[model samples]
Target: MAVTDKSVLYQHGTLSLLVPGLFEGTMTIGELLQHGNSGIGTVQDFNGEMVILDGHAYQVVETGEVHELTAEQSVPFATVHFDDPKVTTHETKLTKADVEQKLLTDYPYKNVFYAVKIRGIFSHMLTRVVQKQEKPYPNLTESTKTQPKFKQENVEGTLIGYYAPELFQGVAVAGYHVHFLSNDHSIGGHVLDYTLAEGDVSIQPFASLQQHFPLEDPAFLKEDFNYAGMSTSINKAEK
Candidate 1:
């Protein structure tokens, strides 16, 4: 699994490096946190968006196709800790350890969290819920712009997972709620291509759809989302 310059590794999306031994494509921050021995590679895009590692990209294409990137450069994934606030500051110096300590002393049970707000289509089927990714194609904004429940200091690392707020907020399909990925907060910058389905429960119906997204947090997704619960038909048509 040694990486060589001539390896010509394959990736999940557009950007990623060639990993050596690590596979599985995706891991919850908590999972990787517990096992730090795991090796990591650059993120890349295949036919769909996926986290690329070593030689293999971690993802599943509804159609069967794996894409390898032509450009060659090392992609860096920083495990940062924010003692300040979660604002637009990409330039910082912090490691995974620093963020972990902040969470242990802050958030309850030493769990990580994100203060979120739902500002789109609330009190109805279209309520936009922006978690790791913004919702409501038109209004891609942070609802907790002014005041975030999960204060910047309370949590650690950027969010990279999804949440189904039914755990914290009542299930009326309204407002925004923080979804927990894993506590890893290590994974970032992933792109995935999505296709349409026959019967989706959400607002719109997507026939041929593709979405480019990133999983910035290292935490594992909240169980409340439970796959079926989290799978909602986004009004992707607007996009």
Candidate 2:
């Protein structure tokens, strides 16, 4: 696929972008909506999981319930793109790693970001939702220790994710960062691992990026944001 400005990655905040004191959320749901129609992110207080598809944002709480964002809900971190990816559908057996490997191998574009959407019925799926945190929040790696995990069988859902360039290390996960939303909408969260019995995977590569930083928040402006060991912290938090 040829790279073009028509495809742009719109991102808000950064992974471990705020280290000393994590800002709860700097951008509201309404504000994020203007950027793109599809992507994944975490909600304020790290209370639950967020998956945006088809221009609507849905919050999946720790209890495994999915809710649509209302009022001025916000997020400290999110990645979205105006997705209209080239579509390809196939029936095959694959694991989470297999899906990622296949995409990278087929596309083989390491420098650009790809908006990925995979829908299928899973033979096995494992997912985790981060717990809500109180003020004086801990770093992301520490916060994941309390994340509630669930396993489901014979489930159908869509996997929303992105493949980021390794060059964007501290800024993004640098690899596959994916979240899951089940067909029933009752069960979904940050994907840990899964076995897809059958599914369709679509990929759209973006040659450009547009980032929005939250400067209005006092904490964002004041925090020193120690970057020491950020690579280790992000690896632990994502897995």
Candidate 3:
């Protein structure tokens, strides 16, 4: 999908495919960045949590190591858009829930997509990075069971991710699906919780979401994705 409009959110692949173990990546990091500069995703085979900021991709692995991804690195699933904030708010001493509530209250278009970026010092931060999967891969929920989690205090970083409506649960995470990357590139992962010390919250709302499927991957092409528990699995694995 070609997204000339900067307001549109560009997504590659779906959580529905990831839930059932379709880990093969059809889009390269280089290609994924053409559509947006800031977003979140995972590397091929769920190797780590992917955080894109300032037009560069970083992988936060299970060992709490952060690597700047090359253009050739493969991305199984991601959501990104041009980091042009329509509204920017300065906030201090807010919890994760507080931030979410503020965004929702400020932008109450329940069915649209919202890209969020928060950069500042965090008094408390908790995150988890999924381990890379091998062949005969376990489902997303099962794989995340052994994922390594990390916590830090007074860490400085940026939170990059999106807020999708509940109606789009399978296509994307229903609520806030954010990943963190520290200023020094030392700590980062899928954010589980945090308390913002002080920061700038930027929001860009999009009326359209362009989803590109992995039509070339045999697993993505042939898998029966009509399982009854897909939503349950996504909630279990992501939240």
User: CA lDDT, every prediction?
Assistant: 0.21, 0.82, 0.90
Candidate 2, after superposition: displacement of residue 45 in Å? 0.9
- lDDT string for model 1 (1-239, tens) is 22221112111111111011111234233232222211222221112222322222232122222233333321222111111122222223333233323333443421222322111111101111112222221111122122111111222222221111233221211122112211232212221111111111111111211211125423212112232322132112101
TM-score of each: 0.18, 0.93, 0.97
> Candidate 2 has which clashing residue pairs, if any?
none
Best by lDDT: 3
Candidate 1 off by > 4 Å: 1-47, 55-59, 68-110, 113-239
Which numbered prediction scores highest in TM-score against the true structure? Answer: 3
How does model 1 fare in lDDT? Answer: 0.21
Single out the weakest 10-residue window by summed lDDT for candidate 2: 1-10
Give one digit per residue, the lDDT tens place, for model 3 in 1-239.
Answer: 55557868999999888898887778999899999888899999889999998889999999999999999989889888988899988999999999999899887656799988999999999999999999888888888788788999999999989989988999999988999999998789999999999999998899789998887888888888876988998988899
Query: Which run of 10 residues does model 1 get worst, by summed lDDT?
Result: 197-206
Task: Please state the error at residue 29 of candidate 1 in Å.
Answer: 20
Better of 1 and 2 by lDDT: 2
- Candidates in descending TM-score order: 3, 2, 1
